[model samples]
Target: MTWLTALRALSAAATSENDLQQVLDLVADTARTLLGFDFCGVLTPDAAGESLVITGWSGLSALYVDRVNTDRPVRLDSGSPSSQAFHSGKPVAFRDITAEPEFTPWGGVAREQGYRAIVCVPLVAGDEILGTLNGYYSPVHTFTGYEIERLTLLANHAAIALTSAHRLDQLRQLNESLREQRDALTRSEQIHERLLGVTLRSGGLDGIAAVLAELIGRPVLIDDSRNVVLAKAGNDGELPDAAWRAAANIAAPQSSAPVPVGSAADPTRRFSVAIAKLSDDVAARIWFPARDTDLDPVAVRAVEHASIVISLELLRIGTAVEVEHRLRGELLADLLGSGAVISEQVLQRAHRLGHDLSRPHVAIVGALSVSGEPAETRLYQRSLSLVGDLVAPYQPRPLAAMHRGNIVTLWPITDESHESGSAAADLVQRAIGAVSRTVDATVAVSAQAADTATSYGEVYRTAKGALDIAVRAGRTNTVVELGDLGVLGLLLQLEDPAQLVAFARRTLGPVLDYDDLHHTDLVQTLRTYFASRHDRNRAAGRLHIHPNTVTQRLRRIEQLCSADLADPAVTLQFSAALTVQDVASLN
Candidate 1:
């Protein structure tokens, strides 16, 4: 082809093609055809601008290309004609590679490739040199001025084509980015509209979860503030415990963005979590596990919309709970008051709250046994949730209320024929133990189950009295009842403090006086001895002493008090006196 026709072909290729590789290939072919060279190649600088890399070539041996690339880069300061032309911004020619001293460094390579002469022209645009276009000749031939001029013009066109290819690449990338952003905006709008429709239709948390699962094409779960699973959908039983724990940890922080869990590169082990805040300091969290973990931007937007709907549902449920708790607290306060009766209105209200008043019910009052520290608001809320969860499996649907610095619960007895108050009290203590485990507090319960309205009021008083006795007796995180107290309960009910003190001094005064005079612990030894049911080995274990030491303390106690060693009445009297002493000291 003529130079004019070659130039025209180069322009058409540059304007029509987008791939840089194809453009470079066309430049190499055109340079070889119009310039009448055996081989032609295009070289571009590497990222560090250190050397020219052979990016495109035509009719060149693989061995020559390997030598030019791997053996050594064509550096700007190297003796290679291409490097020389690129650095100097001009055409460089070696008339005879075998004899020319200027071609000494690359002469051996050209001779091995069967080329006796070579010419290299710099591909220049404005003042910047882009690369070098090289041509090889098999026999020695001097390049004419006309030939050099034509080659230079062709090199200039190659530079323009390369520059156009670079600009086209940048424009293509920018267009892709704009398209992605527009698609994302459209997806976000669709999710917003769907969630808004769900809200307008009063679709609850279950509906919201169903919608989210459908949108993300993954399993969805919503957890309340207490970590109780409120709603779950589309989980095919493939989720593990670790996934749930990871979701909980992510949802603990109130972030608006979806926090990804597990290895992000491995979709089977990855998921996401988001939180939605509710009223009354409650929060609902949405979890998207790795059923279909390749969630796109649209799925993420659906999770956000699901979170909003969950927040609204949680607020609605929390408001209703608050109203119910308030009404239950009012009813409990009236029922426990003096001269209160179980009237028709009270029974109807109890039924509304899912409690049966006609059945035998256990009245339980619980208090934390810490001195001078009332429960914080957060602890109270946690305790309420825990108690509700604990009572859910039991019968008669217990009513729990926080009343006057205590947690009061009314649990019904299902079996009237074989009503066991002890079993009911055990359950109450177990429930309180669970609450204490969650709240970092030692809670004690006083329980009394009865069948009559008058008996409920009396049991309430009895439970209160038992609680006071348990606190003073150094019991914590346990259940206390009137039957367990024995004589101590009767003594606690005694109206006069002076008489109670007199009863204590009369039964155990000698041992107390001996301990006071000699600085011994005879009174404590007697108290522990009776607490362990007079078992010397068990008492020794409690006192962290040898069993023989307990025997010695008991002998000393009997000698000091001059009391009989084997009298049931004396043991009972002395135990009651010790309890009375403890109660007096607590006051």
Candidate 2:
């Protein structure tokens, strides 16, 4: 057949939408016929750098075809004409395969394989060399220029077909791979969603831990700061010494480590430790075997998910604990306000809420005259602590409350009378003194009530009264007793501002004159001074003023009254006079 006829036939076959192998077979057969060669075959490079394999052949036996690897690499840099064509990116025409220097090595193999002459043309696109198209013959023959050109054109067409086939094959493989990856991702998401749902519904950390352990196929344990075991799975044996060491280090700081856990002879002795800090005072560590086969990616993911679940659970439980504690305090307050007698029932309820009921109780209340910011909170806590210390010796334990932003506390009081009330009031004054030393504020103490019910209310009322008096009288650090103030206490508790002001003006006429004229704060100074038992340091703290200022005000008060405050009789008269004025002004 003519070369043009062969080209026309191959083109028509290539456009027939036939499989690649069929197209290759047709081309190989057409080449053998048109080129007058006994043998013609298509050889493609394999992945490995080895000999090219015959993909399609016209005259080759089926045995040779079965033995070839289509993906094998061919040595194209050797001196053979085919190698020359491959490396030089051109076509090579050989008259005799045995005579060519490059073909000498393969000449013997070719003779053994029944081949004589061979022509090779490289299949190239852009700069890349894909493989080679070859034609072989059993008889040695000189190829004409026209025949070589025709063969070269045929090789180019074959190269285009092979390239297209390779591309289509690659696209098919890629599409299959993408489909597999997408399916895997969908399965993973489904598993994650199910696991999340199970964790949310599970009762505690153990449920989540168990689920994670099952999912990851590894042993696990969860622990809190108190060294309490929250959850565990797998072997029940104690953690190896190395693992314990790792856990200890993790507790100190957020970190991870691998430590040997088993026998020295064992190759799989290491455990991976992951630490996460939940809060300032809490942390968790996860330990899993570090052996490659034991802890896979799934195990790693389980550990991660478990950490989140445990952390969230801890936060929820901790918040609940705190809320329950606060609620107990509120309930106690409610009971006190309800006039219920303090009994074992109330004590048990308090104990259950984490309160030490054995402590003697003294109720105290404080009001902030200024904004309640961070600093104020600190001050309030400190004040509560100080009050706790003062009341601690009197009770088995001490507890304080911020009853609606007012500082209130209860002390275990064994004795409730005038003397005990005096002592309680005295301790409160000292607490107020301590608070004043740090911040500018006043505090009040109430007389001890006969029982918890009346005592809590009385202390609350007294503290509120004292706060009101401090604001109006411009006083600080003073303890006020409702009982001691007599009818005046009733007036102070009456919620009448005019009554309070009138009483203050009437009773302290001389002191007010001095205060108004000399711009002295006698009323406040006197109140705090008396509340502190005339202790200059304590009074100054309550007033949040300089000790020297307290001293000056006291001096002015004595001067204006022209009375000797040093005399017990005179002090008593002044106290009674103020009490009367306060009561009378109430009307």
Candidate 3:
């Protein structure tokens, strides 16, 4: 074949989608035809580097090519052309093969194969030396320098082709990876949409559990503290051994807390069990199963998010029910008169309903200026919510209603040992403290009643009086006990606002004048002193003034009022004067 024909054949072989062996065969045949060689072959390094395999050959017996020991290194110092060309990264030509010591072992075989002279060229690309290409002649011949150069150029072209094939393999692998990731994302989106639709339509916690189970394609079970099943999905039979063991471990008293189940099986299949405390007497347990897939990370995360939503809904529902029950009890109380009959009915109802109302209780009345029709209703609802949290533990069965635009709650105590009047006073005080912290409002507690009947009337009166005092005194956050008022308490007991104001003027008129003339806080100082029980040190500390200053002021106060400081009767008179002073100050 002519050089033009050989070049055409090489171009076609390079472009063909064929196996490496077939391409190597075409290259060897083209090289022999173009160079006019008797024999030609290609050698490639084996993986272990112990030998070079003859991948393709032309003009040689298949048996002889197979037997060639190309693996062992041929020494260049011994003057073998093939070994010299491979090590030097250049072509080598031998005009006389028999005279070369390095060729002695393989010379006989070559002669038998009808080859006497040989030329070899190294196949190299960049810094990589892949192998050597060899050609043989039928008689002793000398290769021209031009021919050796041409063979080197051919070898370089082959090396470039091999590098291109390697790069293509890498790109194919990367494409496959991206495809897998895209497919995974699509699957995740589908699962999310389906799960969301199911959960939304669920009427309660049970629906939520069903949706989660369906999404995960696994079993789920939910129960309350009584082990009564609230929801179930997937398998209805007994749980698997692993699941059962997990449940048993979490069934312990201390294990009432949430347990992340299935975390042990597959780190990615992270199922969890959670027990939520609804009230002191109520709790719920939920089981979440993870999806079984290679995408365990995604499945586990989705299940965890779903569990959180379920837990929150369950807690909200439980709280709402408690509030509803309390409101119902309060409504029942209001329907009956706020008298003895109502007290007896409440006690009897507690016994019949098996509710433990035998506890210290108090009536708390909360007054807030609610405006905006919608906002006012919401505020009242929130107030009921607060009352439920406060009374649920005591089983007081709070009765609530909107009385004169105020939220009034009558908390009933069935325990005969607890004085209703005292209990009511304490409850009002606490309610004021708690409510004030939450809102910019004043709260008051009515005096505790003897029973439900007396409680209705007394609670309203005390609450109204406390609220009036709170508002008039400019006390933003305060808990006032009507019983602590002494003479003022008696006036409040008689519901006489006019007498209360008159007493204030008689006792505090002179002190008020001293304050006006000196531009000093005598009224404030006097109130603090009285509140501290005449303790000068405590009064000074509260006022952030020197104790001596408080003492001097108290002496001046006694002189101005013409009251004896050493007499207990006079101290009582001054204290009553301060209490009544607040009533006038409020107005």
Candidate 4:
């Protein structure tokens, strides 16, 4: 084809062709065919623009092309024909290459390839030189003006096509990058929206965990500061307890950023964790048993968002629990103090808290055997917690409360408690076991009439009185029940201290007055003698006095009371009177 036709074809290529490599290849082939040369090659500037590298070649050996592109590329200031044509923006011609000193370095290449005449033309698009186009002639010949002009025209057409193609490629790449960024943003918003949905639904820790696990495609576990698992998902109902236990003990994180419990690069330990502090004593830890690659940014953000949702959920739950405890506490206080019938609103409230006021319940009261006043509210609160937990798992669950410096339980009657105080005894045993593990040492429980209290106030009062008697008598970590104490139960049930004193005075009144006036050991000797079963030596040993001193005191007691110590009936009367006196003193 002629120069004009070839120029038209190249112009068409500039409009139609978008591939840079295809444009370069077409330029090289058209130059070699139209210029009647042995070989032709197209050179483009490298990214650094310091040198020209061969991008397309026709009728050239691959070995030479490779060397030109790599080992010995054409530098813009290398003084070679291609570099001169590019810098000067003009066509450079080398005739009779065998004798030219400028072509000495490429002389052997020229001879081997049978090229003695060469021409280099810069491919210019407007003011910028995009690259260089070169043609080699085997025969030595001088180029006509028309031929050089035609070659220059071809280089101009090639330059325009190359420029258009380069810009098109750039636009295409920019479009691609923008598309990828849009896709990433959509994915991020979706993740955040899903997590927000969980919070809006008030899905507790388990719900948060399930959604996060599904989003991240791994097992998720949530634990508190106490190492107890609050929720878990996607573990197939099995997890390494030791691993989670250790993970829960992490340092309280100030931020909710995800922390790696184990390196993702390490196969044995692959866990990512984030923490949310629920309170001063509690923290919620989120864990992921992920695979061997670090979590992507999306997954990391999901974990952080989950930690935040967990914090909100815990706050909501904690506030609800506090409100529930306050309401229950008020109800229990009224029940322990009032003898009136329970109102409907009170029953409904109790039902909400899982209490059945209609059932037959007995009051059990327990107190610590230690003597000092229990001034700290925390101590009672802890004791109440311990007591409540001890009886929480029973059927028809009992209601427990802290009342009047003691742990009071309203236990529901069952067949197992057929006997009076049996259920109370069991409750006391459980309380003792539970309190022993707490900061409090132990407790003494009392239930006077476990199945027979006429009113709520009477139930509490009898239990309270018996607990007081038991604790004063050093009965720690045990139960006190009237049915188990035989006749002593009757003496303990005496509600009047003056009546007890009057009965004691009726029997031992004469001797008691004489001992007080004379300041003698007669009453003490009588008690010791009876306790020793009339053994004078044993009674003396007990009082640290001689047998003769015991005999003298006993005879003096008999003279004062006008009673016969040798009579069995008189001895029984003294025993009854002394028992009443002792019970009165403790009461």
TM-score of 2: 0.44
Q: Report, for every candidate in turn, its global Cα lDDT versus the true structure.
A: 0.73, 0.62, 0.62, 0.73
Model 4 lDDT tens row, 175-206: 88898768767886787678778768877778
For model 3, the stretches where C-alpha displacement exceeds 4 angstroms are 1-186, 217-298, 304-362, 365-445, 448-461, 464-498, 516-519, 524-551, 562-569, 582-587
Can you tell me which runs of candidate 4 are displaced by over 4 Å? Answer: 1-196, 199-202, 236-238, 242-249, 258-273, 340-354, 366-397, 416-453, 465-492, 495-587
Of the candidates shown, which would achieve the greatest TM-score relative to the real structure?
1
**What TM-score would candidate 3 get against the native?**
0.45
The digit string of per-residue lDDT tens for model 1 on 1-587 reads: 78788777777767774577788878888988988898888999988888888888888888988897767678867767887898789899987888777667666667778888788899998898999888888999899998899889989989998888767766777888889988888888888778767767887777787888888787787776446677778864644343354343343455555786664233456556677876435487676765444667788778877777777777777677778778888888777763535788888987877778777766676765335245566566556656777776766688778777677776677664323555655665565545444332333233435566345555555566677667655665676766567865655444455776787798888888888999988788778888888898998899898999888878887787777757898787777788888655432
RMSD of each: 8.1, 12.8, 13.3, 14.4
lDDT of 3 by residue, 1-587 (tens): 77666655665555555545666777678778777888998776666764556777888886677557542334344446665676788888887788777788777667768888888888797888777778888888989988888777776766555445435445656678788767766765665555555555655667767776766556777776445567777776433334453344453334333355543433444545655553443356666553444325455544544554555667667566666656455554553345444455666755554343344335555555422121255455545555656665654345554565555655665553335645653554454334323554456665554353344555466566666766555654445556645554555554455776778778878888888998888778878887887788999999999999988887888889987767888777777777766554432
TM-score for candidate 1, please give it: 0.60
Give the lDDT of residue 194 in candidate 3: 54
Which prediction has more favorable TM-score, 2 or 3? Answer: 3
Q: On residues 338-422, what C-alpha lDDT tens digit does candidate 2 reach at each position?
A: 5435567776776664456443344555544343222366456546556655654642444555565556655556665546655
- After superposition on all CA atoms, how large is the RMSD of candidate 4? 14.4
- Order candidates by TM-score, high to low: 1, 4, 3, 2
After superposing candidate 1, which stretches have Cα over 4 Å from the reference? 1-17, 33-36, 45-161, 188-361, 366-383, 390-397, 403-407, 412-479, 489-587
